[model samples]
Target: IPHLLELMGFRSSAYLSHMRTLKTLEQIGAAASCRVGREDILYQFDVLREYVPVVLPLMLANVLCPSVLPEEVATAREHVLEVQQNIGENTESLLCELLHITAYRGNTL
Candidate 1:
């Protein structure tokens, strides 16, 4: 068990895998109109934003309650709706996919 733990130590394999793909793509001369190297960086940041809506419902429930002050509940509701609006920015075609991904792999995001 200790040997297995050492194999999966501090550095995560997923992050290493992502970096490996990015570097390998650049080394092999992948081309793009925009910067290809930046694509993965943007994706990493976008991922943080993309998962919010997926967990918002459960999060709000955990933090909120019918016993809480009415005003606090209202404020929390608005904040959640605002996040939903941001997720739906321009369009919400990806919302369903985000939900699916979160349901299947919430920890991964």
Candidate 2:
């Protein structure tokens, strides 16, 4: 369990120390760090991915439809297109290393 926690980046003294320094810097206005949680970040990306299907329709509608969307909305849609293109161009895959529940059960680093 301790090993797993370290692998996941908690129970690691070095990481905790770094986080402490970062927090201090943020407090003194020297640096800014994210306050959002993992779930929040994941949810935002999930929402963005959900818009993939409508991207083409939205772009086509921009040409055919008579109504003009607000500038901010147009800019946001362009942002989505850029994000989608970025994702599509990427070719990296995450490493697969399953953590074990018992002591020293999985592959060691």
Candidate 3:
């Protein structure tokens, strides 16, 4: 679910296709970013107060009506795989993941 939500802003409704979603946010000096927390996924945007009216709709549109293009999914998958590979190489991260696996066992953490 987090992986899917992470792509929410990769593209938006028809009017905001390709890179327009991100480009529009960039033009307004805004940024759309997300992270997976221990319990939930956080999707946030930063923009000037005056631009909330504009940014809010766009942000909502991205969340409610994402394009989720196949190319974007492929790219995201590759990126995730690369990050996992890197984590495997980092001892601290590997240990953390191992600890979670061991602690959770058959349960979701």
Candidate 4:
């Protein structure tokens, strides 16, 4: 999926956004596979988004197949760690809040 998106000339920002969606899909699939209740799954999904810009890829890694090529989970982990370190504590908190607000807005009509 990632490779195909890249080959089709998707920009990096677009690719990252799509990757985030893929991660969400994987989580929902995992929840379903485990026979989780629909309401519980939705709640968990909402909680998962709160950790966006930080732990998203780690959560995604739990659901992704290990044999997939290009190792996007690893890349995402590295990127997140880099951002966490470079931005330090205060900026990281602010960015997380901003990401949350943006995500909330995107989810709303």
lDDT of 3: 0.73
Q: Rate the local accuracy (lDDT) of all candidates.
A: 0.37, 0.33, 0.73, 0.43
> Across residues 63-82, which tens digit of lDDT does each residue of candidate 4 receive?
44222335554565566666
Global Cα lDDT for candidate 4? 0.43
Cα lDDT of model 3 by residue, 4-88, tens digit: 4565444656557757776888789998787765578777888889989988778677667777678877877787777777886
Give me the displacement of residue 77 in model 1, in angstroms. 0.3
After TM-score superposition, what is the CA distance of residue 52 in candidate 2 from its true location, in Å? 38
Error of 3 at 35 (Å): 0.7
Model 3 regions lying over 4 Å from their true place = 1-10, 13-15
Q: Regarding TM-score, does 3 or 4 come out ahead?
A: 3
Off by over 4 Å in 2: 1-38, 41-69, 93-109
Question: Against the hidden reference, what TM-scores do the models get?
Answer: 0.25, 0.23, 0.82, 0.23
Report lDDT (Cα) of residue 6, candidate 4: 23
Stronger candidate by TM-score (1 vs 4):
1
Q: What lDDT does model 2 reach?
A: 0.33
